[model samples]
Target: MNVVCIGSGYVGSVTGTAFAVLGHPTTVIDIDPSKIDLLNAGKSPIYEPGLDQLVRKYIGKTLFATTSYQPVHEADVVFIGVGTPSKQDGTADLTYIKKAAELIGAYLHPHRFTVVVNKSTVPVGTADLVTAIIEEASGLKAGEHFSVVSNPEFLREGYALEDVFFPDRIVVGSNHERAKNIMRELYHRLVERVSYEEISKDFAFPYNPLTPKAVYFETDVKSAEMIKYASNAFLAVKISYINEVARLCETLGANVLDVARGMGLDSRIGGKFLQVSSGWSGSCFPKDTAEFLQTSRKYGTELSIVKAAIESNRKMHEFVVEKIRRRLKILNGKKIGILGLTFKPNTDDARQTQASVIIQMLLDLGANIRVHDPKGMEMFKAVHPHLHVQYCASAEDVAHQADGIVLLTHWNEYLQLDWKQMLSIMKTPYLLDTRNFLPKKLLIGLGYQYEGLGIGTEQEIDGGIMNQFSVLSV
Candidate 1:
């Protein structure tokens, strides 16, 4: 199949590259020449683990990048993986998606019978909207010349390659039976796990592939679009639920790690999103949840659970800020060091990160911030240039002369840092592990005061329930 994915952001870039690796003639199209130039030069404009290798291997051959929509007509499947960023009122701004549809329409060959896939996360009725736009632009009859299919992407940023290549379920929705079958044909080889070894040999596939093979799910256009929103919002709620519990555990002198582990053991409650952290702020959760909620209101309905999740997610940020406040007492002129700036690790995406909100709160209280990240610093600075912050070179640089340090993002490099040495350089050794990620015993043994969310803090032996347990202050 000849595949063309519009918009070379995370979704388009990963999706287009994956299809190209499957021996399809794939071209990634974007308006930005810089991104196209970068892709053609064998470099991914955005950071996704194992994506560059595939791009490099196939750039000059099966995989290609361009700033043109000329391939739309020649393509068997054209995935519109453009970004629909959140508007100020939290509705998705479909400017890019609309523009992409317009371009696709202008260049769509009326007789090709192409399957125009909505790979971007759009609202319920967006398929009809896309169908209308493409029909108007191309003067083509719907269901005859071209059909829009809602095949929303379910990729996680750090695990884009894994999710794409080994998805748990591939939900495709369209009314047209031929379009559905073609969509199935588009991923038939992958779903059947054909040539799985040859295609994935060079790529560093994400560690955990729980499902043996991908489930090919079929549904209507609107349900498919809603699946993307519902999935993310539920995951956001799950994360918020655990983080909220983690705060309670801190007071009750219970370890949230144990609580989460115990809860995860139950088949009903999975262990995936149970891990505690600063809050659920990443490329998808914040924007998607807000947009999803706004969508409910627009239709004169309510998603109360999703709304609570958003509020709870906001409180999770405040929870971390409060942790900092209680430990340091005063925030003014404090030399605060931040370990990670990205929303999550292993990607350069700093969009809607909890770190920024927490840092801004600190800055408002007069805390001088110094930060370092393995990969996210540049993007963070670029995203929030107005916020005055000292961008340090490394973890050591961030630690130097710092009063209190917070581990916001759990990057692997931050874990391997010389905590003993970092502790030595600190003016005040107040180490806050927001992710419960660092070595608590080592840091505490080294005489630096260590703190982690939901981990039992320094408290006296309170003999109440599970045996007489003496929990030392960590």
Candidate 2:
């Protein structure tokens, strides 16, 4: 099968590369000529683990990248993996998806029957919109030469390769039987191979396979689109709920780690997203949750809890900043050190990152900032060059001559550093573990004052509880 993925970004590139590895001839298209050139040269535009290796393995043979839209008519399957970013009012901007459909329509060959798959996370009724746009542009009636399906992607950044190779479930949303069968066959080999490997590590393949492999759940297009938004919205709600609980735990003399562990062991609640931090950030959760709420409003329904979660998360960044201000007394002349700048670990993406927000707030308060990130300094410097900040080579360099240190991101490199050596160079040995990635016992043993969200010592328990409760109530 020939598969063409539009918008060769993080999702499109990974999805196209995976299909190519599965023996399908895959072409990834993008309007950015530079990005396409990089991909065609066997180099990835984004920073993802295992992606470069996969691109190199199938670069010229099975996988190809281009800036032209002519490949849309050459493939039996076309996946629309463009970005639908959130607008100011929280609605998903479908301009890119619309343009991609128009481009695909203009170049589609009349003889070829193509299955247009909506791989981008979109509104519920977007598949119908895409169908209409394609029909209008191609001047062809529906079901004559083309069909639309919603096959939403559920990939995470750090573990995207692993998730693609072994997904929790494969969802195919289409009404036509022929389109469904072809889609199933495209993934049938991978599904059977995975099952065979699971049952027997060294399983032998039959020369002529007779039985049809069943691996995907077939549903309508609307449900599949809803599944992607619902899944991301629920995870966002979970993170916000835990952060709210962490705020309460700070005052009640209760350890959030213990409480989260006890709650997570219930099986129904699960242990994911229970760890408290400076709230959720990155590309998916924040924008998707807002879009979900906006969609709810459009349908004359209110997702009150989800709305509260979004608002609370926005305030959580300020909450971390407030903690720093209270400790240092004044920020005008204080030199603060920030450990990590990316939204999370293992990626260089800084979109909607809490570190950016907190750093901006500190600068507004007239503080001198020194920052260090394992892999995000170059990206961070691009956006925040005018601020009174210095980017250092290592965490120790940033910590030197600083009155306080803030751990905004929980990168493994930050965790592996020597806490004693980092504290030794600081003007004041005050450490704020926003993500709770520090060893409390070790920090205190080194004679440095340690603080974390919802993790307080016995003295803080008595002195801070009343004050926290009073503030929370207000």
Candidate 3:
């Protein structure tokens, strides 16, 4: 199949490249010339693990990129993977998706029946909206020359390529049987790829070939859109739920990691997204949850659980800030080192990162912030150019002359630091593991005061019942 993915951002580039690897003649379109140049030169503009290798292998073979929609009519399957960024009112701005639909419709070959897939994470009823736009632009009747399908993407940021070939479920939302049939055929190879032991070993983590293959859910357009929002919002709620537990654990002297592990052992509750982090922040969860709540309100209802999750998520950063303030008497003139900047590790996406919010709060309180990240610094600078921050070369550079160090993102490089040596250079040996991602015993043994979220603070003892322990003695 000749496939074209519009908007070569993270989703578009990864989806288009994966199709090209699946033996389809794929073309990725973007408005940015720099992204196109990078794609043509066998390089990915965004930082994703295993993406560069695939791009390099297929750049001139079956994968191509351009800034033009002139050749889009040649594609049998067109995926609209553009971004629906969040607006000020927390609703998704669909300007890009609308423009892409019109562009595809205007240039699309009227005689050929093409399946236009809504690969972007759009609000419900977007398929109908896209169908209307396409019909208007093409001057053709719907279901005659083209078909629109709401096949939302479920690929995570760091694991996008792997998720593409081995998804948990493949959803195709279409009212038209013809569009559904074409999508099934297009995804047939992926379904087959998951079952083969050799291919599964190469792709699946831990080489689990016995893993169940991805299931397909054929639904109407609206439900498919809801599925995407509901999945992300539920995961966000899970993360916030554990963070709330972690907060109680901080007072009652219970280790959240153990608590999470015990809860996850039950088959009813899986062990994903239960980590006691500062909070959940990224491209998807915040935007999707907001949009989900907005959609509910539009119909004269509200998602109370999702609303609490958002509130809890926002308060998490404030909680961390208060923890730091309590440890150090005043924030004025305090030099703090931040360990990571990106929302999560292994990608350059700093959108809605908790670190930025925390750092901004610290800056407002007159604290000098020095930061270090293995891969996210340049992208962070580009994203938050107005925010003044000192970017360091390495972990030790961040630690130099700092009053305290806060682990924001759990990057692997931050995990392997020589904390004993790094602490010696700092003005004070205070280590705050906001994600609880570091070793607590090792840091304390190094003669440094260590703190972690929901890992039982110094004030709490070993029981749900509390005993007298000083928070300052750690």
Candidate 4:
């Protein structure tokens, strides 16, 4: 199959490269000249482990990048991956999708039956809209000349190539039998593999241990689109639920880690998104939840739980700031260090990250902030250039002369930081583990006053740590 992927960000860059590796001649289309040049030069414009390696191996052989949509006429499958960023009122801004669809329609061959796959996460009725637009632009019937598919992506950042090569499930949503068959043939390598035993023997199937084979689910277009939104929104709600539980655990003097582990041990409750953190903020969750809520309202329904999750997520950031305020009674002129900036580790994406909100709160309180991340600092600075933060070169630099330190994203290297040296350098040895990701016993032993969220009576459980609030009694 000659695959043409629209857009060159995370989705197109990784997926297209994987397709070329899977023996499909893939061409990535991007409007940005720099992105196209990077792809052609055997470098991925976005950060995904091993993606550039794959691109380099197949660059001019079976993989290509270009700004022109002229190759659409020859493509058997064309995937639309344009951005659907959230609008002000929580509705998806479909401006990019519209333009991509228009260009695809204009360049579509009259005789070529292109399987137009909606690779971007979108609303339920998006496939129909795309079909209508293509029909009007190309002067051809949809099923006769082309077909639209709702094939939403489920790739996680930091582990994109692994997920692509060894997917647990592949979904194709379209009414046309021909289009579904074409998609099946396109993904036959993974879906119709030799045996379930072959895949299980390697990974132990940690992603989906219960599933045997990588199931190629065939469903209606609307259902396929809903699956992506519902799955992401459910995970977001699950994260918020645990954070709520963690808050309650703090009041009741219970260890959240133990409670979460007990809850996860249940076969029904399965622990994927149960970790307590500053809150869920990433490229997908915040945007998708808002759009899901907006779509529900547009069709005369309401998702009250999602609304609460959004509000709770905002409060989670405030909750972290309040804990900092309680520790340092006055935040003015305090030098605080932040360990990580990306939503999670191993990806350079800084979109809608929790660090932005937490840092803004510290800045508002007149605190001087220093931050460091192994891969996310460049992206964080690009998105939040207005934020007055010192971009430290290393974790030790962030800790230098700092009054307190907060570990937000649990990068692996943070585990090996010289805590004793950090404590020695810091003006005040106060440390808060926002994700509960660091070693509390070691930090406490190292003479730094260690704090973690929802540990057994560590915070706000019995009137503050060691009667520190007793001084506030008036």
Error in Å for residue 390 of model 4: 0.7
Candidate 2 has a TM-score of 0.90
Question: Could you arrange the candidates by lDDT from highest to lowest?
Answer: 1, 3, 4, 2
- Sort the predicted structures by TM-score, highest score first: 1, 3, 4, 2
Please, what are the lDDT tens digits per residue for candidate 2 over residues 1-474? 999999877789889988887788999999999989889889877777768777876889999999899888788999999999889998899999999999888878899789999999898999999999999999866677888998988888767766666667788888888789888888886677544343222122222234344357789988989989889988988999988888888889787877788899999999888988898988888888988999999889979988998999988888899999999988998999998888888787776788888999999998999999888888788866666689898787888888999998888676567776777788999888887766555566676778988765542332221222212111
**Candidate 4 lDDT, tens digit per residue, 1-474?**
999999999888878987876678999999999999998999999987777777877899889999999989899999998788988998888788888888899999997788999999998899999888888888888999999999889999998876776777888888899998999899987665434344333331244435466778999999999999999999999999999888788779888888888899998999779989999998999999999998888888989999899899888889889988998889999999999999998899898999999999999999999999999999999989989999998788888889999999988778767777788889999998877776565456578788887774353323222233212211
Best TM-score among the predictions, by candidate number: 1
**Cα-lDDT of candidate 3:** 0.86
TM per candidate: 0.95, 0.90, 0.94, 0.93
Per-residue accuracy of model 3 over 305-374 as CA lDDT, tens digit each: 9999999999998999999999987999999999988888888888789988999999999999999888
Of 3 and 4, the candidate ahead on TM-score is 3
The lDDT leader among the candidates is 1
Off by over 4 Å in 4: 193-211, 457-474
Worst 10 residues of 4 by lDDT: 465-474
User: What is each predicted model's overall lDDT from 0 to 1?
Assistant: 0.87, 0.82, 0.86, 0.85
